[model samples]
Target: MAYVITSSCIGKKVGECAQVCPVDCIQEGEEMFFIDPDVCIDCGACEAVCPEAAIYPEEEVPEDEKRFIQLNRDFFHRD
Candidate 1:
């Protein structure tokens, strides 16, 4: 499963996760960073480095941030 970046990342573009991602799957959004699930290797590297603890495994995404699951997936699927 891929890791999902949630709303906790909003207004908190710390970028540490992006810096450590081996696949370069992380992309910048208007207010935060998103993990491209199609490209992500599930390495968990980003989760270790994220200062906001905004990263979670897709199945483990918090109830409050469930929408980010689709948001992250959609970001990569969009043209």
Candidate 2:
């Protein structure tokens, strides 16, 4: 599964994860950063580098943070 960027990243456009992503799948959001599921290589680099711990695997997304999965998907779908 792909990694998803959660709400905790809102207003915290930290770019550490983006800096480490090899596929360049991470995209800037209105507040946080979103990982394009289609482009992510499932490398887990984003999750390892995120300062806010806002990145998580699609299947491991918590109940409260589940919206991020769709949010990440929609961000790219709309493109």
Candidate 3:
């Protein structure tokens, strides 16, 4: 499964995740960075480097933070 970036990253787009992402699926939004689910390789590389600890596996995302899974998708699919 793809990884999701949670609210902890909303205002602190440190972007460490982006640097380590081998597939470069992370993209900076206005307030944070989002993972392009379709492109993520599930390598967990970005999650390991996130300074805010904001990244989680799709199925493992916290209950309250689960919305981020869709938000990550929305960020890439926005029209």
Clashes of each: 0, 0, 0
**lDDT of candidate 1 over 20-71, digit per residue (tens):** 9999999999998999988999999999988899999999998999999989
Question: Cα lDDT for residue 47, model 3?
Answer: 85
Which 10-residue span in candidate 1 carries the lowest summed lDDT?
A: 70-79
The residue-by-residue lDDT of candidate 3 on 3-51, one tens digit each, is 9999999999998899999999999999999999999999999888888
What value does the lDDT take at residue 34 in candidate 3?
A: 97
Q: Go through the candidates in order and give the C-alpha RMSD of each one to the true structure.
A: 0.8, 0.9, 0.6
The sequence of per-residue lDDT tens digits that candidate 2 reaches over residues 1-79 is 7999999899999999999999999989788889999999999988998989989999999999998899989998994
Q: Tell me the TM-score of model 3.
A: 0.96
Among these predictions, the greatest lDDT belongs to 3
Measured against the true structure, the TM-scores of the candidates, in listed sequence, are 0.94, 0.95, 0.96
The alpha-carbon root-mean-square deviation between model 2 and the true structure, to one decimal in Å, is: 0.9
Clashing pairs in 3: none
> Which residue runs of candidate 3 sit more than 4 Å off their true CA positions?
none
- Count steric clashes of candidate 2: 0
**Poorest 10 consecutive residues of model 2 by lDDT?**
70-79
Q: What does the lDDT read for residue 52 in candidate 1?
A: 92
